[model samples]
Target: MISKRPVHVHEAVPHGDEPPGCTSRVSVEVGGRVWLLDREADMEALWERMGEDDLGADERLPYWAEVWPASVLLGRHILRNAEVLCGRMCLDLGCGLGLTGIIASHVGARVVAFDYEWPAVRFARHNAALNNVPQPLWTLMDWREPAVRAHGFDFVWGGDVLYEKRFFDPLIRLFRHVLAPGGKIWIGEPVRTVSRPVWELVRREGFTAELLTVEKVALCGQNATVNLWEVTIS
Candidate 1:
């Protein structure tokens, strides 16, 4: 059972005149269960921030700030298979608002959620508190960093993370480094041009990739199709 705890207040971005994007609450339903999450109300402000100061590779993408459709589908998958995760150590990579990790924790997994953006980590922590699930350890660190490479996880999960071709090598390396023996990876992505090559690479690396499900989701007021894949090292 989830416990209700006092909400810890973190210093949020100032909303002066401009709308505060993180003020709204979104209710996400997965496997007949509802998880309440705090979401950024305005994406334009976040995009503007990303554009400022000649953004670099890691800093240019503000995609982590929004809850994507893939995350929702991934959360449902986790809930549906909660029994398999009991007592396992799970890693929610690029956790954004932390829905995946929170759901895993609720179902008995020991979860650790990490995101490259500081605001993402903060919001993830807050959302975990809101849902009253055991809060996963939240960290603000890039995947390329050596510190993250040292850790091992029984399960690695990500949502909508394979959109960019440039991220493929780094992600593959991270998967190889952190995945424990007999570990599995769960990914949810919208079918995009860049994803096919990544899957080819996964196959070449000796992992058996299987399509688990296809879900049609509403994203930014439009319907989008997302695919969930399960990969295990052969």
Candidate 2:
């Protein structure tokens, strides 16, 4: 569980632009259970557009915690299709909020969730404790680092990580280095055209792929074009 701190220690951004903060929340149903998240900070980031300031590296803030729709879709599909995650050693890369890892642990898998963003790591840990999920090993490791050149895992998981072009090549190379022989990787992507190259690259790496459809309806809204990919490394 997360330890409580004094309210004066941290200045929280108001939920909305009003005098009274609006309640920001998201709920997803996964593996026959519902997960509820209340994140005013994420809502503030949404209103800020995540790229508004200097709109570049200088403007980027630490701990920007927005939950993506793809995470919800893919986490559910992985739990459904994979025979048994129980007792498996899993690595969740770019594990925003650690939803997928939490679900994996819920099913008896040991999970290591990594995120480059420090804020994401903090929230992931808090969310895990809040949901009664196993407290996963959390690290602030970048996939492109040479230090991770030899790290590999039985199952690698990620959700909605293909949003930027800069990280694409590094992400693929990281997966190639870390995935064990005959291991599986799962990704959930929206119908973004840029994501096609990622799929092509995965196939070129000698993995067999198939797409699974997921129905995701969060309190924020409904996402219909969510598709989950199950790729098995040969």
Candidate 3:
């Protein structure tokens, strides 16, 4: 019964062009409960802005501004399996809009969520308040040089983080460094050609993975299936 609906405008103020930092609020229903989230109002505008900007190697566009289907699928899975995560240490990587972390907190998991950009972390904090969940430790973090402790987490998860080929090896190293003994990892992803070699790569690194579930998701007039995989050290 997950649904996405537009926010009603109580006071409409007309403007020619949307300004920077302009945002929209959305309601996402998961596990029979509605959660509120905020995102950038104009995706194309942000992309255009990024095009004109001077950027470093690590900095990228505002891909975190939109709620992707993988996040929804992971959120749904967390809400449904709340009991298993209760009191467990969980980390949400690239926690865009903080939906999965908030849902995990609601179900009583100690959550630590991080994003590459500060805006995404800010939005996650705000969304946690909106959803009435205990705020997780939301931090601005670059996964390439993470400032986290070794073997610190029990369950580390991410949604749609496998978009870039360069990140594959770094991500696997991060997983190995941070995951505690007997800990697990879950990744939710859409059907993508670039992601086809992921399992083979992980298996080569001595990790085992299995498809846990597939969820059909609709976003912005498109329908697709999101796959969730449970991975662990072999």
TM-score of each: 0.84, 0.76, 0.87
Candidate 3, residue 165: Cα displacement in angstroms equals: 1.4
lDDT of 3 by residue, 1-234 (tens): 111111111111122222236378877767788788876654456667765453345546666677788888888888877898999999888887788989999999999888775557677777787788887887666676666778989999898988777778888998998898999998989888887788889999999989999889776577879999988999
Q: Give the best candidate by lDDT.
A: 3
Using TM-score as the measure, name the better of candidate 2 and candidate 3. Answer: 3
TM-score-wise, the better of 1 and 3 is: 3
The lDDT for every candidate, in the order shown, is 0.73, 0.62, 0.76
Q: Give the TM-score of candidate 2.
A: 0.76
Clashes of 3: 0
lDDT of 1: 0.73
Using TM-score as the measure, the top candidate is 3
Q: Model 2, range 127-193, lDDT digits (tens) per residue?
A: 6766897777765565666233254577887776675665567777777788777787777776778
Ranking by TM-score: 3, 1, 2
8-80 in candidate 1: lDDT tens per residue?
A: 2322222222213567776767777788777664455566755457455344455556677888888889988
Pairs that collide in candidate 2 are 63-119, 152-178
Steric overlap count per candidate: 2, 2, 0
Candidate 3: where is the Cα deviation over 4 Å? 1-22
Could you report the Cα RMSD, in angstroms, for every candidate shown? 6.9, 7.8, 8.1
